[model samples]
Target: MAAAGPGQHPGNRARLIARFGPMAGPWHDALPTLVDGLARRWGLDVGEAGGGGTSRVYRCRRDGDHEGVAAAVWLKLTPDPVVATQEAEALSAWSATPSVVRLLDSDLRVGALLLAGVEPGTRVRESGWRTADVARLLADLRTAPRTRTPLLPPLGERITFMYDMAARRGTHDPEVLAHGRAAALGLAGTGPADGLVHGDLHPGNVLVGPGYRLVAIDPRPTFGDPDFDAVDWAIDGATDEVALRRRIAELAALVPGMSAARVLAWCRATAPLTTGAPAFLVTPAGLRG
Candidate 1:
């Protein structure tokens, strides 16, 4: 499947430029040369892998001098320092796990990664994945040890911070914000278990291949309850409100102790806060149903 570059979609590009401004154009223009140089220095072959939101990933081949390997590696390029650092730190933390992508190196200044790419497979959105697949992937991911070293805050805290930012920026809808705050407070009161949560665990981030095995990519690593991860999969987009609720119910059932009502509220609360976020972060279809 073809992936469109950042700003290629008129509507999305406009919103991004509005929020982030025109500086992205210059940074993007410099990516190809920067990636090429990095590949040469690292003794790897590099070329375009794909593009989404503010980053363009490249397919990289390990240096020929190294032992037996022919497949190219993958490199993700971006101008956002925080996001680049988060991805690198998360990948490094989980590198021992064969199921997660391997991170070879990262250039913080340029926001680039030299990574080991998994064999290509259908994205979860296109792979006809069911709720079972999502549950299984979550179970595997939750096995990673949780850390509170402050690489990224917990999901609940992050949601609260986003609300504060939106309110300060005067971009938040008051009713939605109020509901989100209330729901977040409720979730907090429950004292949900904390683990290494994939802050974004929607279908698009999942990849499936032979034997129906699933692997996840592009994690926004944070610490939180596993149930916090379910919201993204539920209310992505459904023209019919009832249908959306049903999907939420189905997903909540897949995750123990999670209520459909809580998931729905989280989805509604967070969606608006992401309105001006990069395309990779916020899907044009909104969430995905």
Candidate 2:
């Protein structure tokens, strides 16, 4: 487990560069020095670098023990200080819970994090998990304690960004995007701010671990309506309305306050603006719903 930088994957470098636009070239140039510095300081033997879009990750091992457990960690680095600080705060808040990956170490100044590694870390989707199983995970995550940190952005801000992006790109119908913005604003005022919501929860984000049956990793944590998290499964890459309806019903039942209507609103609002074919964004007929 030796430290490696982000230059291995040329395609990943391009994708990252595209993600950052004008700042990409300099960001790419800076990765090697940053990665090496963190590895040395933390005594981390970092492996292959992974492309995490907003951040970079590496499979790492350190010479240490934690309560009789060997030190295996995932090292992540982000250029944005805001994202780095918020993520560290979120992980710290949920350190006591087994449902989420623990924060082993952090250096917010460099936007680096050392996260506990999950054994046999298969993604939930690759593990052949059913929809109900995912719902169960969301329900459990909702029980995790809230953060006292004041910097966590409201979920509405994310929705607004999508809506605004779509509007500027003119790739989505304005009417539909407007509906989503309104719904997000309305829901923000009405929905329950029950507990900490893994703002980016989806099948890919959940992993099957040896210690915990299903655990979440790489959270964009926020304090908000648990329903917002619940609806992610319904609208993400939905192709069939029949199946989508079933998932919506199931999720609403699994997490209280996540009604079909509310979830449907989220789909209609965020779907068209989403990257892939979101469940309710456009029908198979190529018409905006």
How close to the true structure is residue 250 of candidate 2, measured as C-alpha lDDT? 76
lDDT (Cα, tens digit) per residue for candidate 1, span 146-262: 666576666776667667767777664566556656656566546454667677667777777446766777877777666667765665555556766788777666755566766
List candidate 2 stretches off by more than 4 Å: 1-3, 6-14, 17-24, 64-70, 168-170, 235-242, 256-260, 274-280, 283-289
Off by over 4 Å in 1: 1-23, 64-68, 96-99, 160-174, 185-190, 235-289
For lDDT, the strongest prediction is 2
Question: What residue pairs clash in candidate 2, if any at all?
Answer: 180-269
Global lDDT of each candidate: 0.63, 0.70
State residue 30's C-alpha deviation in candidate 1, in Å: 2.2
Listed in order, each prediction's TM-score against the native is 0.71, 0.83
User: RMSD (Cα, Å) of candidate 1?
Assistant: 6.6
Candidate 2 per-residue lDDT over residues 1-289, each given as its tens digit: 3546544566766766655665755666677777888888888887767756777888877767666544778888776767878888877777766778888788888778888888888987677566666666766776667543577877766666656767787875666666667767677667765467677776788888774477888887777766666656775546777767777887778764456876766565555654554544553232224
Model 1: how far residue 141 lies from native, Å: 1.8
